[model samples]
Target: MNKQELIDAVAASTGESKASTGEGEGEALDAILEAVTSAVTRGEAVQLIAFGSFSTGACSERTGRNPSTGETITIPAAKTVKFTAGNSFKDAVNAA
Candidate 1:
């Protein structure tokens, strides 16, 4: 689901209003997201038990062929976010 949908779901689950969750200032869900994003952007890892972990990863620069023109192109190195699901999350998905 999208951001609004997620916010709605969390608000519902916590018996809070949508405005309280993320629509207004000092929103709880938004704060949580911001914390996670800030941590990841700093090359730090964020791990939530029974959910997953988010960490930074890297990709080396390399040469690749362009599918359209079949011409060689240089791909620059970049940082990436990685997520590894915990056992509980994996079990839930598998069960579903």
Candidate 2:
């Protein structure tokens, strides 16, 4: 579901007002975003249990021919982030 739906569900489940849930959710999300950003910037992994980890990898520079022009050009290496879903999360999705 979307962010608002998640906030509403949290507020309903905890018997809390939407304002409180929204504030709490926003803070929590900001923390997560900050942590992941910092880790990725340092070329580190950010892992969350029963969820997944975010990690970066490099793509080596290589030569690839253009599809249209057929001209070979060097492709620069870049960092990428990847996520591996946890077993528990996979199980929950499969069970559903």
Candidate 3:
């Protein structure tokens, strides 16, 4: 589901009124997401029990070929985000 749908669901579950402009749960969700994003951007990990962990990883520079021209090119290394699901989350998905 999209962000609005998620906000509606959270508001419903918590008995909060959902404003047209997404005031209550939407703001809370946005704050939570912002916190997670800020932490990850700083090369720190964020772990939520029964959900997942977000961490940073690296890709080394490598040579690759262009698909169209078949010409060799150097691919620069970059930082990446990684997520590993918690066992409870895995179990829930498997059960579903």
Candidate 4:
């Protein structure tokens, strides 16, 4: 589901209100997301016990071919975000 749908579901599940400004499910989700983002951006892992962990990984510089021209090119190294689902999450998905 998209963000709005998520916000609605969260609100419904928690018996909270959805407001554009103060004390709402949307704001709470946004805050939680922002915290996770900030921590990951700082190269720290954010782990939620039954959900998953968000961490950073790296891709080394490598040679790649341009699809259209088939020309060899050097792909620069980059940082990447990685998510590993927890066992509970995996179990839920498997059950589903």
Output the number of the lDDT-best candidate.
1
Cα RMSD to the true fold for all candidates:
0.9, 2.9, 2.4, 2.5
TM-score of each: 0.94, 0.72, 0.89, 0.92
Global lDDT of each candidate: 0.95, 0.82, 0.88, 0.88
User: What is candidate 3's lDDT per residue for 16-53, written digit by digit as tens?
Assistant: 66763356544677788899999999999999999999
Error of 4 at 70 (Å): 0.9
Q: For residues 1-96, could you state the per-residue lDDT of candidate 2 as single tens digits? A: 987888788778988787766665555545657879999889888888999888988889999999999999999998888889988989999999
Q: TM-score of predicted model 2?
A: 0.72
lDDT of 4 by residue, 1-96 (tens): 988888777778777776642245557778888999999999999999999999999999999999999999999999999999999999999999
Off by over 4 Å in 1: none
Worst 10 residues of 1 by lDDT: 21-30
Candidate 2 has which clashing residue pairs, if any?
none
Name the 10 consecutive residues with the lowest summed lDDT in model 4: 18-27
Report the number of the highest-TM-score candidate.
1
Relative to the true structure, candidate 3 reaches a TM of 0.89
- The 10-residue segment of model 3 with minimum total lDDT is 17-26
